[model samples]
Target: MTAVTKRFGQFTAVDNLSLDVPEGQIIGFLGPNGAGKSTSLRMGLGIMEPDSGSVELFGRAPNVQSLRRVGFLPEERGLYKKMTARDTISHFARLKGLSASDARARADELLEATELGEFSRSRISKLSKGMAQKVQILSTLAHRPDFLILDEPFSGLDPVNQQALENLIRAEHDRGATILFSTHVMEHAERLCDRIVMMARGRKVLDGTLKEAFASLGQGARISVEHGFDLAAALSPKGFEAIRTADVGHGETWRIELPPGREAQDALRAALEAGAPITGFAPEEARLRDVFVSLVGEADAAALEASLAEDGVA
Candidate 1:
């Protein structure tokens, strides 16, 4: 989509956002809640129309022909409580143009891959939350679409299930499918994305490869020390702001903020001079959460998270 804009009354939900999903690449659409990630995705998938600009899928405007080759998992989780897991998946596959036999076979294969084969005959209402999530994801992939768009695929999942989902995404990517997913959790994107597109307040704030994004943030390091360490005293005199600090058993760890052109080791040397008994020290790569704070401001980032928790919009 290029220069796509969506509005609700006087509020601009998505402000002239432009994005491209390259074939066979896993792109992480990252942002806090209400940052327009969902809105941008809806426009691209033809679920909602943009008041202006254009959206294209596979070289032309998004339409039925293009949609057949696409698989989508929306943010909200929903499945028919009366339907069996296998039947639910097969139903969606049939909608995507699969024959009865093919859909059933594909659904079985997917259920097995996700380790939910035992629940294949279980009604949706009888499954646990994680089990239901896996089933929903299987339903999305039953047709084997060439392109996949997942909005917050990890939300509400336990660690084990989240890891399982990540493996599934990796397998799909290895099959040469193009994947685009959105998420508030930084760890997922940090591990899976080949490229990242960051949004804030309905605008694209950053877009690049992981390495490029880190390099652009200058330099920094996470510092940990043994007991009797004073992180604030060590860096404050040198004009370095410890962006974050945490007490760790009789000691403290600091996330030092580095000015442009400064190396992470510089902070180490400063710690040494300050007589801190260093337990661990290394260069810190900028995390996506840090990038969010830098781009969107601390207050807004915190507010977004709070809203997500209270409203359950993950």
Candidate 2:
């Protein structure tokens, strides 16, 4: 995107943010609730217009053909309450240019894939949220579009269904479909995403591999030695932010956040020098959750409001 901007009057939903999702890759469009994820997606899908900036969906203009070639599961879970899962999915597939027969066939295939085969004839209104969510996923993939966009796909599923959806996503990525999905569950993203794009107030905040994003955050590498671990004088001399100093039943841990340009080797030496039995020394590379919180957590504060004012200029 180049200078992408949008507003609901004075309330800017999206800012001049830029992003990229290459073919055959799954980009984790990640953010918290009301962080402009839905708004940006609506713009990307041409469901809404940007007040200023460009959005190119698949090298072509965002139009009917572009939308048809892309399958999307919106965040809002609204199904035809009276319609059976089978009819609902097939109907959407047919609308997306599938032949009636093809749509019916795909409905069965995805229903079974998502473990909703037994509920195919069940009306959406009669199914539980998890069941309805499965149907929504089936609808999104039934058309076999060139690209897939899933908005909070794991909202109302049990562990089993969540795994089913994840496997299906990996399968689609292996099949070479451009995939972009928004999610807040960090562990799933750590395992699934090739790259992650974090957003706040509709603007792209962080974009890179999970490791890269972590490295770019407040700390470099985190080191947690064994129980009774104390390098206070050793570590304090080197400027490590001691997050805590206590034994939490399970194990005595000292959560330390290293500063930028500062390597963990310094801490390693201190631990060794202090005779703190080295149990674990690894890149506590800030997790996706940590990086996200570090970058976007303060968006609700006055500091963020001022930052947004400067960033909103496009």
Candidate 3:
């Protein structure tokens, strides 16, 4: 996006946002409910145009040639209500400029890859949500496009199916597709993305690798001590911050957020030096979710919701 902005009268759907997507990497575009993620992608897909700024897919304009090289799976579940799973996928491939035979072959292969082999001939309307989701996924990738964009691809799937979806995304990444997707799930971003663009309020709050984005997270490895009360004083002598001391029926747990850059090993030694008996002392760092919440305060969530409910039809 180059100063991309989409507006509906006075409401701005995407506001002067720009982003860079590197080749052969999965970039997680993460945000809260209404953070312009879908709007930006829709503009890029050419289904909707940005009021200003431009979208480039595979270094070309948003025309048939560029679009044919790109695959998009929207957050919404979309498929022909009455088409068979096989035909639904094959039709999309045909639209992408594939010959009928080639389209059918690719659709079959993708359906099998998604474990929907037995349901290949079944009508999409008769399939369960999970199964239908699989067919929708196949439709997007049937052309074997060089770029893949997925919006909330994992939403509404069971753990097993989620893992299956993840594996498929990774396989495409390995085959050299530039995978870009918007997700509310932080763990998926942490695990699958090489880089992340975290947006809040129509602007990026964070954009970088997980390591670079989180380096600012205060140093303190959450460490647990065998004995609660006695450990605080002991650890403090060696300069360990024992922030939380809570009893969970079985034993007392202490959370230590260490000072910035404090080595976990050094902290453990210090705890031991203070004569703190340690049954377990593991350092816990701030997860991606923690960072996201910290970036988008609770107050912004309401406004974000309103932004998403705005019409994108124009």
Candidate 4:
């Protein structure tokens, strides 16, 4: 998509958003709810027309031939209630242009791969919510498309099922399928994505490799010293800004904010040379949540945390 925009009445859901998904890469589309991720994805797949700009799939407008090479799992999931799991997968695969025999074989393969083999003959209404969702996901990929687009694929799954889906995504990538998945949860993106694109309030906020995102925040560390010791005051003279964060059992923990181009070791060296009785020390690592907070401020980050809490993903 290039500068694609979409609107719902007075609300502009996606605004001048341009995104590129390179082949053979697993890209994570990350943002809290109402961040325009779903709208952008819909536009990309030509499910909804953009108000401005343009969208191209497989180098042209989405059509029958191009769409057949792509697999999409929408945020809203549904399966045929009376159909067996195996039949459901086979049905979708056949729609994607697979022969009847090949579709049934693919269904069996996917059922066993996801450990849903025993449930393959069971009706969708007889399966649990998670199992049904998994069946829908498998249906999307049963035809082995060259590209996969998944919107909030992990939203309704438990931890174990989430892990299984992650592994399934990796396997698809290993099979040479390009994948792009959207999620509000940071941990999944942190573990699985090669690059991340973040959105907030219908605008793209950040887009880059994980290392580049971390480097944008510079460096910092956590330091602990003897109780009642003023580490902040002691480190101030050496050009390091330290804030008292918490009091441990026998010490006070301080967060040292290093200036740009400074290293964490410099802070440790300065503290040791200043005769501070240190008890614990650890370099602060940048998290995706921290990056989001830095980009959109605390309020939006808190909203994201609330979304995660509602979904039971800490």
User: How many backbone clashes does every candidate have?
Assistant: 0, 0, 4, 0
User: Model 3: number of clashes?
Assistant: 4
Candidate 1 residues 185-229, lDDT tens each?
A: 877899999999988888888888887666667567888888666
Residue 3 Cα positional deviation in candidate 4, in Å, after optimal superposition: 1.0
Error of 4 at 261 (Å): 6.6
Decide which is better by lDDT, 2 or 3: 3
Local distance difference test, candidate 4: 0.92
> Worst 10-residue stretch by lDDT in candidate 3?
305-314
Query: Distance from true position, residue 216, model 3, in Å?
Result: 3.4
For candidate 1, the C-alpha RMSD (Å) to the true structure equals 5.0
lDDT of each: 0.86, 0.78, 0.79, 0.92
| Residue 211 error, candidate 3, Å | 1.5
All candidates in order of lDDT, best leading: 4, 1, 3, 2
Q: Which ranges of candidate 2 are over 4 A from the true structure?
A: 220-285, 297-314
> How far does residue 80 in candidate 2 sit from its true spot (Å)?
1.6
lDDT of 2 by residue, 209-235 (tens): 876786787764445556555655457
Tell me the tens digit of each residue's lDDT in model 4 across 13-57: 999999999999999999999899999998998889999999999
lDDT (10s digit) by residue, model 3, range 1-314: 67788888988878888888888989999876678788888887888988888887667668877887899999888888889999999999999999999999988888887778899899988999888987888899889889999987877776788889899999999888999989776778888999998887667788888876676566555555554446667677666767666764545667775665576778788877777656667766667766766677886654444433441201
lDDT of 3 at 239: 69
Task: Indicate the TM-score of model 3.
Answer: 0.83
Candidates in order, TM-scores: namely 0.81, 0.79, 0.83, 0.87
